[model samples]
Target: MEGFVQNTILITGGAGFIGSNLCEYFLGLGNKVVCLDNFSTGHQHNLDGFIENPNFKLIEGDIRNIDDCNLAVKGVDYVLHQAALGSVPRSINDPVTTNDVNVSGFLNMLVASRDEKVKRFVYAASSSTYGDSIGLPKVEDVIGKPLSPYAITKYVNELYAEIFSRTYGLETIGLRYFNVFGRRQDPKGAYAAVIPKFVMQLMKYESPVVNGDGNYSRDFTYIENVIQMNELAMKSQNEGAVNTIYNTAFGERNTLNDLIAYLKKYLSEFDSKIADVEIVYGENRIGDIPHSLASIDKAKNILGYNPKYSLQDGLKEAVSWYWDNLKEK
Candidate 1:
């Protein structure tokens, strides 16, 4: 990240979980960060820590608007497009809004980045892009038909990024994230991810629900590992690394049952009574897949990605954060 002091990076959705983390990291590295957010899905408190920092600036805008996208991309060295309506059920309920924000908004960013001639355009792809393939340990290539509206939107992102790269000659990198979780992940919404939701439920002594038989598995990735992928994608000097997608994951899989077990074990450290909390079983969710796993070989071999945190390592940190920062709320 050295020599990045001269860089002015625009992080769309800068108030959201993943984007806020990017803003914090870039600011710490002495980079100028312009955070463009609508606050529709992103929280304001995530920016409270760095709001007054000289290296930081916030633009209250949505990526769905080209004018807003233009303003944010102006005078930027790199664009990290993380703003999107995430969640399968949410998209299933309202595919129109999802397409507008994810697909249309992504196009806006690409056009703005191309017009501005930014060095690179990196984006958040999803493991759901491997939908219906029944492939174990998904690779960068060989994807299946999308299973949900959200999945289709994410797949379109990869396709657009590739076309934008070839046609406009803009450098683009797509990180196909597989079930990412960590600090700042919101647990209040109806579409909250399983990890954060379960963590909070356990903290309150509420019975966490395990959809189906609790045997479904995922390649749950940590936030720090995602940050590593973003940094490498932005700074890679390798010609082969540009304009391709990489699986940003821990390269391992664990079941939902295993997830709850870890949550109970870790939470009990702070409150012994939490060890007795029970989990409730529910019917399988609509459009839910059985398992998701990622093969990180392409990322490791191409982008030089080395994941430092295992599921256990990340869960320890995440559990502690929820306990200290969100416990009283």
Candidate 2:
């Protein structure tokens, strides 16, 4: 069965890495797409290929502006809310800005979508929502106190989304994404993810820094899997689907040390000079979970969510992409 869907989909932050990819997938299926982005954290070049597409409409706007959101959602059928200020370090450094973009911006989008009578409001939640919970496989009902301002914002999103659905009758779905990585994911900047950072470092034949002892484990998800969850969440018709959240991950875990080894091994084939590069370690940053493993049974049984790529498989694809695009540039 087709997922809870409509003819035209409104995707906020449509120029970012995940948003752009979602735009491509939905537009490919002959759906009219309205992409709203302010280009604060997202790049304009990310949506270059789709700007001319007849099914795609680009609105240069910010989610912080309720007027912009209302205008963008006027005739939207489904809403995919992917815009947010990401990174715990960034949030720790500038909590107020993060709260404004992630919390205030999220609430504004929800209100706009509800006012526009959108069919489904799907949002990008974070695994950081799990926060200080020490559970091996995190469940939706179970959560710990948010450790970072960023985590608090995401958890607050879920809370607000739940209330909106109950009071305002807005149907909402949240995808709590794990460590997502893949093509078009930005590798530049201080708060870049470990994979992309390592890939860039390996390209320069430089040692990549490992945070803490490198034993910290994470359920590193691929961008494709994340897109799948978003698609499934938006289209799900089951009554149990709405006003809920799901873990979008591979149901597998990997450590930083292992990830580094994999990157070095795969990247070394392209340039033998990277083979001998050593790794440096530093203290673990605050707001990071010690270990993360997702029980995908909820997503698997409910949404038919099937992640086709393993950690190694996803990394290989990401490594190749970085080698071709990032290295050349």
Candidate 3:
């Protein structure tokens, strides 16, 4: 990962979970990093660790504004476009705002990157683009009708990236992230991912709610794996790897019951009472697929991606972080 020469990298949504992590990692590699975020769903505290770093710069702005996009991309060598409104239910409740931010804002970033002549534009795509497919392990070439407004926006993003790559000769790579979880993922949101929310709940000895039967499953990727994929995308010189999408995941699936059991097992190490907490089941979520898995063979063969953590391994790390950071608060 350190083989590439130092270059300035611009990460939009740099105060969000994945964005902040990328900012820190790239800065650690001796690269100048510029963070552009609006603080809508992103928290400034996410940048607390490296806010004072000389190589790190923060610009508070929204992606919906073209000027903000242009300003963020100026003089940047690569753009890791992570700014977007991410939530299936939230999109359903308000498709207009979701589309405005995810689709329109994505276009703004693409244009800015193309105009600035960035070497590569790596972005956060979603597994929701596989919507309604029912395929066991989703591949990039195969996709179905998007199930929700959020899914539509993500699929549209892939299209826009492809067009920009073809029509304007802008290098682009889309990473379809699975359920990513780790340190600094906010657990106190209406649309928070299940792992953090459940960990926080179990920390307080409260019941963790399952939106459906505990059989529904997902491929939960860790933050470290995602960080590796982004770096590979930004630095890879392989021509075939450019202008395409890769599934960024550990390539394994676990049921909701398995997740809860693992969470309880890990958290119980810090608090024995967590093992006694029960899980509550309710109606299935409206836009959620029954199960999701990813095929990382493309990432492995092309970009040399070898994820180091499994679901259980990542949960242990995440649970410990929550215990150390959020338990006392």
Candidate 4:
């Protein structure tokens, strides 16, 4: 909290789910927040609360444009680079655009932050960067070749961050987020994560199709845990911690069936009929891993990280938010 005082934080994709949460939390702590979002995947409704805040300013700009990146970085003390087109399927369809935005645009942000002399640059990395590596619990040092265009972009992000820190001496931290989910995570999109998608389908009494026999598991992280990681990365004075990456997750895994069961059970609390929704099994998605789990040992030891919400704890809060915020609308 004391770290945010007199700090000006530039959250690149501030209109998106994770970035907006950062904006809200930092603004609450009396920090000046400047949000830059092209709204490619982010929504206008996400900014409804922050737009009116005197401490929060939204920059309606794209990261691909170097001028916009430079402009947003000016007079900023720290940066949380969350801007990028996210979605494996979308990248599969348009690798060029994904590379341009995720890779080239990330370069732009690094350059801007370096030139502007921001104290620290923390970015939203992906667990997909772990790629096709065979391991039960993913560690920071072990990674395999990327399986898809999206994964490649994310892995390249780590490379660029490493290069920037090594060459330009820009302080940096990368949080490899695993299956981040919670409020404002767009469920309407074709590439929506399983949790919110299932929640929406069950709410409408529509059958939620499992991408496989509901056996594929993932480290479903809550948005609040993500926010905590970002804050720790931003504030930590640990010399060894800076310029490194950390796994931002709840340290547990859940199968797709468990996701649906919880969604039905929780949504049923609001509407009893939701519990009756049937789940349909389907083919597993191509390029999707069979299971994913993270070792939070690095984050815990280095960044002083402690995840406050587990998958179930997060789902309860998330379900309530969706019911109150999106269900009625």
> lDDT of each structure?
0.93, 0.90, 0.94, 0.91
Ranking by lDDT: 3, 1, 4, 2
Superposed model 1: Cα runs more than 4 Å off:
none
Q: Given candidate 3, what's the lDDT at residue 49?
A: 94
Give TM-scores for every candidate, taking all chains together and pairing residue i with residue i.
0.99, 0.97, 0.99, 0.98
- Count residue pairs with overlapping backbones in model 2: 2
Cα lDDT tens digits, model 4, 1-329, are 57578699999999999998989999989999999999988988998987999888888999999999999998999999999889888899999999999999999999999999999999999999888998979999999888889999998999999999999999999999999999899888788867778777877788999988999999999999999999999999886999989999999999988888888888899999998888899988877888999999999998889999998999999999999877845
Q: Which runs in model 2 stand beyond 4 Å of their true positions? A: 1-6
In angstroms, how far off is 51's CA in candidate 4? 0.8
- Angstrom error of the Cα, residue 242, model 4: value is 0.9
Q: Which 10 residues in a row give candidate 2 its minimum summed lDDT?
A: 1-10
lDDT of 1 by residue, 1-329 (tens): 57688599999999999999999999999899999999998999999999999889899998889999999998999998899999999999999999999999999999999999999999999998998888787877888889999999999999999999999999999999989999999988898988989988998999998999999999999999999999999999986999999999999999999999999999999999999998899999887889999999988988889999889999999999989887965
- Scored by lDDT, model 3 comes in at 0.94
Indicate whether candidate 1 or candidate 3 has the larger lDDT: 3
For model 4, the stretches where C-alpha displacement exceeds 4 angstroms are: none
Cα displacement (angstroms), candidate 1, residue 105, comes to 0.5
Best of the candidates, lDDT: 3
- Better model by lDDT, 2 or 4? 4
